[model samples]
Target: MLVIELRLMQIIGLGTALMMPIIGNLSDQYGRKALLTLPMTLSIIPLAILACNRTTNYFYAYFAFKTLTDMVCQGSINCLALAYLADNISYRQRASAFGILAGVTSAAYVCGTLAARFLSTGLAFQVATFVSLFAVVYMRIFLEESIPADQGEGITQPILKEGEEDNIIQNDDNAPTKVPPFKKIPSLGYYLKARFHFNKNQFADLMLIGGIVATISQLFIMPLLVSPIGDGRLLSIGLFASCVYAILYSIAWSAWVPYAAAAVSTVMVFAPPSLRSIASRQAGPREQGKAQGCISGILSLANVMAPLIFSPLTSLFLSEGAPFHFPGFSIICIAITLMIAFIQSLMIGRAPSTSNAENSTEV
Candidate 1:
């Protein structure tokens, strides 16, 4: 049962990796409400099926439906919500908001797991269906549309465009910027091509840095140092810890070595939210959705690639073939990746801090 569940999750993760950016981009155009509503409404069907039936056919049906819907639902809500916050909040406050949001999610996860201990399987799923339905209804009735149809072009603008110059073009009747042709449904090939146009090695290295940083800081230390060090510096600390964790894990001689190395990894939990906060601050008013989507896409890509990159090497070295008996060989490669990320994090830390005055004056 555990192995089946793990495989199911892995499949779902792959789906999420492919669909997240596309769905996020769609939400930017059609408004978050509609896109958000469709997924929530569809989610109930699979849960309700599981609640009522235990037959093999029903289980397979549930799995199929869930795999499809989970692709749409998993990260879409968070991406849209972060974009919504970007629309409303000042950049200075975004880091705290992101942190609080992450905290709320962690609390919800803990509560749900604890609650599951008390409820039967059917009851748990039924309760989830009901909660999902309630959330959909509440959002439909109460959540005002954050992105309107007319301003959709704003979202499609190049994220790295000069802020002041873009604003000038927006204000002037004579100097209109050329609008790229809008595709209501972007092709999978187009998305893959556009999303991954960067140097693969560099991208992989940077993601490893961010991933390790986020894993260690957010999971272990961010809760403690978030207020004191600030998000960017906390990210730097997390990256440094990740570098250390990688090195230790690589050279580890005993099983206990990996366990000890993990102790130093508690600082990475802050990386994700902190990075989101910084990216949100960088985007223009209407560009938040795009920026956040890009971030999510990068994360998903990393999730898809990490196992492929690490598993083979680990397997080869651990097998009975006659090579140097280094169990830590795979870990050394990981450590090197972490080092690249650490250097990037340091550069980010040393970059000029944006004053509230500058943010306010930005377009």
Candidate 2:
């Protein structure tokens, strides 16, 4: 069951990485609200279908359907939502909003898990689906398009010609102006090509590298931390400890998980914002989104790879029925990854001032 769960999660992670950028770009082209709604609405169908499948073959189908739904709805919606938030919130307030948002999400997760424990999985899932459908309806009714029609055209003006606009816009006054399909469905390939070809910015590279390193580190850390607890002697220790911890956690220490999670989230929430704030102060807001995107993309990639890479390693190295933390190999890897991340951050700081100077000049 554990192995199956791990594999399923890994597949979902990989699918998410592939889909997020596609959805994000789609949101940029269409409106975030509409694109987001489409996925949310579509996601329910799969969950509903899964609720009916009873056989082993049906289980595989369920996994595939659930994974697909998650890839489309979860990945895209999150990317669009974050971008949407960034669009409205001032830099000063963004971090606080993100922190609050993270807390809310964590709370929601805990509540959902508790609810699932009490309720049947099918009923819990169905309830979630209903809530999501309601959310989509709410968004459609209330949410305004963040990208103005005029601004959308203006942003693409350099790449799209006056003649092209005329052809795209027909004679009917009320006819929906035929925006270049590319403007509506931005392709990942095209966006990357344009970004790399036209924008020869070094900051993009920095963001990409930083993001990749961070992701790799996370991938290394998770397996090491989790797998050890699942091994022979380590497994026994972990099982006993977990029971004790669970009891304690249920009691006065119920807050500990949330507190610890908060601490970790606080760091993540602050890190990029702080970096951006310093960059904006010293260098300015030139190419901020692109740089951030590169970093985010790298992190997403890391999230996708972590489970895939770690699970197999854990299975291979750790003995069945062993305590969760036998050899301590995974922990060592995590420690090393942390050290590497620290070293990389220092190196990034010390790198030549050219990028900073350019950012300041652009600002």
Candidate 3:
């Protein structure tokens, strides 16, 4: 089962890696609102399929459609949204903007999980399908284009050569930033099941607690922190917390420990918006979509590598035929890897605010 999951993810990741850059770069040309329609509309098909039936034939049909749709839908929505925000918000204010956006998404996660806990499986899928349809409708009726369709003239959007791009990326001069792995991988749930014996109910509860904390932290705490310490330090703190979160999960002595780790997950939430803020400032005004797309593409490529590294390690450690008795070994390696990235992140000085630079130019 685990091997099957790993193979599925490997295929999904490769496809997503290829697709994200194309989606993002297109957003740069066609406008964020135009690109948004593709992912949102396609996402509903798979959900609607599952909402109708769940026999073995239906299940396989859903799986096939789900994989194909996710290849285009997975990272594209958030990537384009970030680019849209970049178009409207000043660089100095963007970290908070991104944080607020994340908070809203977290709130939705909490609500969906809470709703699903009581609903039957089929009903939950039905509700999800309706919600997805509503979201698409709302977007089409209410959302305005951040970039005009006519502005998508050139194919090339430069990322590597600009002076600002150098400032954005050069802080990791000694340590090139490899994509830090996260909850996107399937191994974490398998590790919990294999080790401490967590069930679906327990998983939902854990996620709810984590989602609540993350929503509060991103909505209230992050806005305040982003101004004082800046994106660099906040990212560093999130990375450290990420390491700790994995470490706690790795050595979880009791079931309660995972709950404690849930609280720690809030700090880890700070990293993505901070990274997005940093990445957004690197682009020229028209290039926001291209910059964010590049970031998503980089992450997709890392995700491609993640399961390959962890899945086999996980199988060996969790199985009775293991070379050693450490069931949590794969997670420990995950933590160690994060710790290395966190240390390297410390060397990253904050990219100077593009808005402030613009203001100075005006004066």
Best model per lDDT: 3
Clashing pairs in 3: none
Residue 301's lDDT within candidate 1 is 55
- The list of candidate 3 runs beyond 4 A from truth reads 148-181, 184-186, 350-363
Per-residue lDDT for 25-83 in model 2, tens only?
Answer: 55555666766676778777776665665578877777777877765555455446555
Error of 1 at 175 (Å): 35
TM-score for all models, in order of appearance = 0.68, 0.56, 0.86
Q: Per-residue lDDT of 168-201 in model 1, one digit per residue for the tens? A: 2243211000000000011211222232343544
RMSD of each: 12.1, 18.8, 5.6
lDDT of each: 0.58, 0.41, 0.76
Runs in model 1 deviating more than 4 A are 1-14, 148-228, 245-266, 349-363
User: In model 1, what lDDT does residue 48 have?
Assistant: 90
Off by over 4 Å in 2: 1-10, 51-60, 148-297, 320-326, 346-363
Model 3 misses residue 228 by how many Å?
0.7
Across 34-62, the per-residue lDDT of candidate 3 in tens digits comes to: 99999999999998988999989888999
Clashes of 1: 14
